[model samples]
Target: MSKSEEASQRPDTPHYENATGGWGSLKGVSRILADQKPTFGAFRTLMRQNKPGGHMCTSCAWTKPAQPHLFEFCENGAKATIWDLTRERCTPDFFAEHSLTELRGLSDHELEKTGRLTHPMRYDATSDRYVETTWEEAFEGIGAKLKELDPGATVFYMSGKASLETAYLYALFARLYGHNNLPDSSNMCHETTSVGLKRVIGVSVGTCVLSDFDHCDLILFFGQNTGTNSPRFLHTLKAAKERGCKIVTFNPIRERGLVEFADPQNPAQMTVRPATRISDIYLQVRPGGDIAVLAGLCKRVLELDAERGSTILDRAFIAEHTTGLDELEARLREVSWEEIERESGLRRDELNEVAGIYATSKNVIGIYGMGLTQHVRGWLNLAMLVNLLLLRGNIGREGAGISPVRGHSNVQGQRTVGITEKPENVPNDKLRELFGFEPPQEEGRSTVDLVEGLLDGSVRGLVSMGGNLARAIPDRARAEGAWRGLELNVQIATKLNRSHLLPGRATWLLPCLVRAEEDMQATGPQAVTMEDSLSMIHGSLGRRQPASPHLRSEVAIVAGIAKATLPPNPRVKWDEWTGDYGLIRDLIEATYPDKFKDFNGRLFTPGGFHRGNAAREREWKTESGRAQFTAPEALTALGAPPEGQEITLITLRSNDQFNTTIYSFSDRLRGLSGPRDILLINPEEMERRGLSEGQVVTLECAVDDGAERVVRGLRVVPYDLPDACVAAYYPEANPLIPVSYRDELSKTPAYKGVPVRIRTDEAGA
Candidate 1:
């Protein structure tokens, strides 16, 4: 049998019965440490993560506490840190041994396991392998190629893996190159939050501070699996629960993180295995049902406000700080109970019960993740969520607001420092005045737009800072083919990924320093800043020695490219900024004086400085100068699927993975191990469809596009999920997601709620 077929036939292991983050978590960490043995200062590096005078964890964007615990890192964070600090090296000989064809056949986990990249390498077509080349040769060759094409023809993509200094330089470099085509990881994830919130609240970020969790009376979580994505957040939830704060969660899968948590930092809890109960209420919301559930809650809250003599609604606050209440109320009233029940998979009374909890609570905070944003109407979903929160005056309150937990530690920071497709999002006048360049006024291509341009032969090159674009993007089969025809493809990365294999005519793999490794520039060792999910900026100082002498910092890499590509601008000192990151911070402060004042001074101020939020301060930047309540045009978050026996497919991450990087083949939290190409379905649904356990299946996208988008050799596993709703690992299932299928306003691909038909694979038979 073929290797792919053999992988599809791997049997499901017994589910883990322990609570999230107990002995099981410690075991997971130990296992990773054992695999990547003799890590470079592993103990010292982990001790400093999320702590004062230390670098931030490269995992989730969770903020550190004022007084962090002895070990603030989580299981996955440890994996990420150790994964970077591994002794294994992918030297020139390693690449020469493995051909591109051989690398392409490996799984995501296997590809990343190859170890850290040691030197700059260029794709040698003659040998069909990557051969070592000096940094100067790679940079000069790429610079020459970029000079040949129009600035708009080449796309500059950034990932969340880099520091804020790198992101700032990347944005500046893109604009200096005469285009604003700065698409980052945000384009695929929380672009919906930024676009949606700005339209109503006048700000593109969350309004809550980390301290707000302490004072909140209630916290509502939607479509976020905090355990796997942001395990450190479990500490915040546990603390809130102990302080008499109620927690309610809505997700299709019963993620162990929200249900209960045993803090790894707490010796008593870890030893006893008596996990602290987390969610006061757990609602199994069906995929793409968040908007319907939110609409139902809004309607019920308004009704209760009337019945209770207007006491439930903050009438005075509404009159003073908001607009469009009457229209929102009318729209909410139009939504029928039957439609809400059918779409949300919940009864009216259940929604009313939750709404009642909201009405009684003086201060409530709503937290969400990609689940709310990776939908067709993702931007609208955020608007509707804001409407529900605004009814009780949650916008500018101390302990009541909206928090969109971002996946990458610095993804939010990248957008904040000016990586965006929309030209207007950045300060054009300030940039033109400071950098002496005419910033492009026309909107640039987003991730989705970039893919379309590639397919149409409009985009000729891709300069990605640090993301696996080939696998992270939708319709991988179609996009990867177009990538090969490009004139240039440059990837500045610390390790090899699937994207490096999709080599263009001029492909160069430039190695950079990881966050855990010291980045010594021309001046001396430097520190980089990272902004967390709550808008707090923390300084990251690497303690370990450099992995290789040839490695360059991301800031230096960007500066090298910029200096080589653009004509020498006297005002911009790329060489000096690359030598000292603090200088870059000074310039960033100069650009956004109000938001980043004293950037260097506040780099290590205990818990880091909070970048002030205008909406949180009640200073709305909207056209009306006040918060606006919006209602969805439709009750459903996603439109109806084409006629067939199709099920809603929600793409998710495994406990062993962080973003697109798969650390191991095991997902301990879900009781699954081995291969990620497994489809999770409810037992009753499996029985109803005459599907058996361990059955290999093929999923085809239910789209009208002539091209067939399908993934084969997926093992079926019965899971505890809502009927007609199945789940699959992201990027693996990403091929089934259409590039054109995205949010209208934000342009985020609908990774969640994808409609697909599953049939038994002929290979398994």
Candidate 2:
């Protein structure tokens, strides 16, 4: 039989569907509850998610509305909760049943399915197993290792799931330990957004709030899939659509959430009517083509202004609130329509049509995610989007601005509370006054920098708040190997993950409380705070009991580490802060009084308080004192691939996954089931290459690092994507992305775009 014919018999061929978030979404939630069979009341716990004074969903950073619905959680949120509240425990006996070598062979999903960690454990090198240890012993050993090494040589990593209080304590603890080597998940996902927006608008975050969508006339999406990444955002898009907002999306694949959505909240929409159409216009731009598309939009807008008596351009806003218009205009004028169309995989008229839509609309909101940020020119990609918005003064106005959707529930919050590698970003003077210590001024290593340090023996220790760092990062061949050779590795987490298997010499696994579970401290049941995507700070209080008796709160864990590593400071009372989380809020208020005045009292209020973004009020915190328009020198930063490896790969998240956590082996939105090791390519591309469905192929990266960087046994499945653009799940595809290949400014690994060649894995077949 022919390869195509033989492959056609496979059951998991790629399928496209238009509907998302109706019955399918509800079914997804039900499946997780049925499969995991939570020991705790899943529905009861879910009812409290994202509600006032209830624990925030540990899934995504999408903000909660002023008045939330009866149920304020999504399908993925349910999975995260159920996963955390699982009945199965990874106790010492469970460890005794599985050795380190045996555990290392399991996939990330399988490792997590083993269940929530129930006790503190240390690597017993003699038995090759993680034997249970007392918390005092674990902390003492970790502290001793830190005392033996230079503080600068140890890196502290924070995951996006950390609470504001936990992040604050972690940051302070690292500072007290005499180094600023702190890196978080943002360094890998949205660092470009932070770096680019700060340079252009003086703020490192997005300008739009959730309510802004209610007033926006036009909403443009670039490289973000809301259905899987942040399902709550679909309601925002649906609301905007119902109000006659023109939604335009530019993505390589037509995402179901962006095209149509069936709201589970609305009974009529769920049971009576068809799915609501979300996007008015859809542009399937080629991978790494966002820059060219953005430049083309600007070029067309300029043309419309010239043709229509300069009415299309917001000249007044540009004259008063921005600089470098002349440079931007000249650069746009120089860009040829042919080049724009060729690079963007779009025609001149399509670009003109979108530009016309923008011109007609009074207020526009530009929304994007990692697609625009994970590139070699990731910073440039965001800068171009900022320039596009600046043309018509979309920023600093109601219902109009740039919204960069963040992944982690507290990723932005972590950065807000000083979990950054850059020391200058922190209020050093306030820290000195509050903690009575001279904070480190030297810049610390970012995630990318830390990985390089691991290889060079510069960084010997890693203290993570929570995350599967080994799998999340790119260039795993070097990173995972270097991880095993570390002198000390400490992971404070709730569940077992792949990162735990790559053991250091003295690895310690510290069990901590999750968000859905109550944290009973010395004072009473403690509540933690989180800052959502809109910069709103709200409280998260858990109602369920702790998953394990041995588990401690993240705040207590950080405080314990601090007390053990540093000498007692009379000014910094670690024990007192751990007892009462309110004291930590008071300290945070004292440190950043302008942002968090009356932090304790205000947190009790419904929907929390806005942290106040300067850019939203026409206040630029940049060097120029105004929003700046930067003209990109090229259409895109992506160069030609090597002769054999022609396609560019963009890593993505499945519907069943959040970050590195996989709940199942299915993605219903894309008709993928039972496997993640499948590549989605365009039918035309597949035919041209003489490839077939279910054909095993190996994707090899185009980098000369003296190591063979490839992901083997990825079956080919035809998908709806632009030519030369293919899609694969993240972390699996992370191996093909070179560590050195990243945005120069942010150092974020190019997870969105990687040049690679495909080879038939004959041996695997």
Candidate 3:
């Protein structure tokens, strides 16, 4: 059977009559009953579709190909795969039937109903429809419009899925055109972690590679759900557990995946029942209370060391490579136990137990995700993680370091290949040396700044490498409105998403090749590089046929735009860089020798290569040549919850969802299905407010700013969450987050920690 025919025949197919079925339907029923379900193993196999070679899901960068024939897939990964392999298609005729205005009125689900775009398209104002356009015309039109705008007014945004080669060329094109306004999905997620790490350590990437997980004696995971977010890491966790590693979890909500994960690799476990125990000590922390918890742990560790009268920390490593120790120690000493317990929602005894685990384990791994970075004090939280690692001299050692799990396949690689609004010291100097042109020294706009600029008409053009910017930004209404004002909006993507609907006066959607599809050049098939969450750089060669014959590689598309926009000033040859992605890798190597030594040569190897992180071996790279300590002051209580607010809402990702991409409406692991309109609340909190399961509640942001944003009539499902805290799906709840509510230094949106009020309307009173 053909791909489409086969997809329709699948048992897990979405039934339009039902509107919601498969795993999503199962989740909805589970939520109603307030119970967890064991659909992960089945969901894993269903997502992969029994494809030959048995590949791992590529939803997040963290997924690694499992051994021989293991069926391993996370809930979100399943959704991503299902979405990609859906039996949906949006042809030119479909566009002809609906005008942009008509499509705008359609729900997000209805718009996505048209299926995926199969060809390049352009918007025609006269017909009020999008018509299929040739690759040359699309490229030429984008180049012309971009040429008209001053480079300063143009912004280049990238998503996490973009390969390293494409990212490198995207950055080169912007630089060649004299603009540094390159914002990406990273800005929306892990920018705070990057900013904090760069200041504390010399590098902005994670210190540990995946191999480090195998050697860890103790794993401290904060604000991350491995089963749903990074299922591939479960194997490592399972291995570590079998070897007696203590895994401690700190998250507000009790994630099913983190609690118990089933391994599809073992036949006995699969045929009968095979599940791995994930967390030994699951600490239920209040939202934005991570800093306090970490500080308390560090303080207890210090106290323990003092009593033992022996060096618990790697003193030699700290003295040689870090600075600011005295200040960090003083801050930790000043924080009282009373304040720590109250703020972190953990008692002194609990802190001591956690510290005791760390004290006994010679090898520890600290893994963090958006939970630690999506708060008002996200940067401080990252700094605190670094401080905790430094306290025990975790860096530059076997099985010990800081690991920031990145969201996209090549998000970190993009940064390595020069995708940054602000140029780093090494990349800047190298760009100057390689291109023989003085790179811009001035800073450029971040994601938040880009939105603000677009709203005010300062940003005239937007070039998205990949991503649905309109749906991804904080305030949906404001962000979409800003895009409407743009003179030109160009989207280079493999699929059609909501961002494509937010047309500029002149808009172009250029079709590009996906990482899973082939990219043929004059030389041969080209390979693209991606950096994993562990800072390991590797190459991916797509074997499947191109989704469309007309589709071009991102590198070629970028080069075409550059050739059309820029005057013939060849500091670095543009035409010569199109076909072979290896040429781009060579440029990256020339620009960043320390990270990409013999980039092309090493990439050809089977397992690829690791970007050297000396700090992983106890070599600190901070000012003063010694590990510096950053003592966090006691968190001053934010005056009691807003007077009359029933519950505080915290935004989170459903198991079947990712960043802003909704693979399906169901959250099987959470027992939620059918729709994402439900809010997960603690049962006690709901009863205290005189609310019951399935009750509709209106969530309002109690912001100091005058902006009004509300999500109404959301169903409430009681779950195992802290009493004062309630959890709702993100992007849908993004409106509740105020633009001003961001981390002080990193400027990350405090999506994980927002103060809001819930109210129920009386029916037929």
Candidate 4:
């Protein structure tokens, strides 16, 4: 049989099997190093990949100038760059040769072989292929189809990678269309963080700016892996470490990046010994047990203050800037130490030590990522973090506040630009003042709601801005199946992805200019603005040439669609905005004058500028004129695994991967190579299940839904994970996540915690 045929026949064929181990475990580290011998010659090529300004990875909003000299680039970022710069092209001929049904059966890698989409393509069911179509025709068809559906039936999904300008235009277009169904990537990840933070402090964003990192005396990291997810964070962490700021980490895994990292940028360190310690204190909190760990710490801090007679708890700030402290304090005191130890997998001494650090630190910053937010009670988890900070008067102070480390470069910026369905509390009456339209006050569907609506057939149309929605959402099969039901699906992307394969009845793929590639227009090479995690907004101009002359900027695409859909609409000046991005900035300046003063002028400045928050200086924006304390009870612990299930499985992303895009077959940081099928299990759990390291096992998800999805012949490796907890790479294990399982407030799928059964596959099938 042919290799492809054999792969198809094997029921247990491992996806990226050869690339499945952690970076530390990848074979012959020396051999790889030898093959990748340090060479300044290759540096420029690698650096160009890192260039921000050129066609930006539509997968990520990372921006940089296309410099001639070598610069910093991660493995995944490199893959994203090459993926965009591939020689392959998905022309009309390629599509004509393959049927949509045939392509659906092909693996993600095989579909990618069709290559870059050179022109707008429309699904032609009669031919069973995608035929090249003009941009105008594509937009007109979409608009006409959308006009047929109830405005509420159309769902607009925005990815984190979209530029601020693009997001603004997209949101504006959606509003004009009369629907507020703006579901975004944030709904899947940090909606809880945004919602929880906003409810407590009246701001939906992190308070600390990048400069705040420099001023911090202590940095507390919870459930975040900085090295693998956000490599750029290493630079900030390194600086903080050098500045004598104590760094503490709380996570289940002792990630190498959190412990020691070889500074690629430091010449002296690289030449001599290139090891730098990252985390001053590492606490291995059990998975799904972050609340216990936090509660213990809070309890200890209270005890310490009472015994030592220290003013560790901010009495004046709490009274003046917060409410509901009595109830919060009552719950904190009621939490038993026994439960804390059992749930958090930490001893009493450890909790006390963490509390000591918090009490002693004059200025502290708490940084967290998705690990704390992709759980059943993610909102409460965020609230706990906020509670800790509020108790210490950390927020609104120099170098002190809760910071949720965002993934994409401008994910936060997208929110700032109004890619949110939730009505802004601080009404931009300016939108009414300028646009002559009253922005809807009603809340709209979030990402989870979008998927639910799709599944139920309430949503008939989907317009995505740069993301693989099918692969990114949990329960892949359900998401993919629902995607097929859409009446019209439009994707503005840089490259092909799994989501593209799950086409709607009438699907259109519109290729757009990448961030690294120049976005030239009638005016000239236009620079787009993006805000970093620190609230700093800067202009990014592409340096490299366009990928294709046919490609359009996201801003242009949004404008084109809006103009084509709402022809002669006097409320929107689509023609004027389509040609220049500065006009959009002017509108933004008008809307958010307090923060975006001289938007165009300030964005041109070096390193851009931060949107100064008066709240950062202790001004309360909450309803009560103070931060509100959220009282979250220790909800009944996640129930134990079913009788037949041996262990609970948690899905996670590898260092080489970002969300849904698999940049490479290997996850170098996790000792994985050439495969992504290995499962990490606790040694004790493995022994209990009669499994050994490298033993192949079949894992079955025991979800509330009756549907059965099995991942077979997964190599199990015993590791230091907590008892009863097992970890597998995501998307592959996404099937285990049930559509019904989600956080109460945020509605984010609990991708981090899933219950499953493991057993030896007798046939190894």
lDDT against the true structure, each candidate: 0.87, 0.87, 0.72, 0.72
Error of 1 at 329 (Å): 1.5
> Candidate 2's error at 339, in angstroms?
0.3
In order, what is each prediction's RMSD in angstroms?
Answer: 4.5, 3.6, 7.5, 6.8
Model 2 lDDT, residue 202, Cα = 96
Residues 1-765, candidate 3: write the lDDT tens digits.
Answer: 321122111222111221112333334334422322222332443433213233334578773532323444444555555454344567778888988888878656566545556778998888888898887788788888988898898899999888888888888788878878888888888998778886677567788866777799999998887756776677778888888998888888666656665565565655565456677878788777788888888888888888888567767766777777778778888888888877787678877888888988888889999888877778888888888888777876778888888888778778777888886533777777777777776677788888778867899999998777787777666567778788998988756677888888899888777665567986788878787787767676665555457778888888888887877766667777776678888888887888899998887443347787755655555564445567675452122344566355678776656677665566656556777877777767777888778788888777767777777868877776776778888777877776667777767777877778776765201
Q: After TM-score superposition, what is the CA distance of residue 286 in candidate 4 from its true location, in Å?
A: 1.0
TM-score: model 1 vs. ground truth: 0.97
Count clashing pairs, candidate 4. 36
* Worst 10-residue lDDT window, candidate 2: 2-11
lDDT of 1 by residue, 1-765 (tens): 421122211233235667899888999998889988846588899999989889789988988887988888999899999988888888999988999998989877777778889999999988889999998888899999999989989999999878889998998988888788888889999999989899999999899999898889999999899999999899888989998998888888778888789887788987865788888777788888888899999999999989989999999889999999999888878889998998888778778888989989999999999889989988878988899899999989889999999998899999988888888888888888888888888889898898888788899989999978889998888888899889999999887899999899999999999898888888898999989999998998997887889999899889998888989989999999988899999988988898899999988888889989999998889989989988678876775743568888999898988889988888888888988889999888998889999999999888768978888999898887888888899879998999988887888999988889987758434
lDDT of 4 by residue, 581-682 (tens): 888888888777887899888765554577776558777777787887766677322434335654666677776567776655666555556567878876
Question: What value does the lDDT take at residue 558 in candidate 3?
Answer: 86
Q: Positional deviation of 186 in candidate 4, in angstroms?
A: 0.6
Query: After superposition on all CA atoms, how large is the RMSD of candidate 1?
Result: 4.5
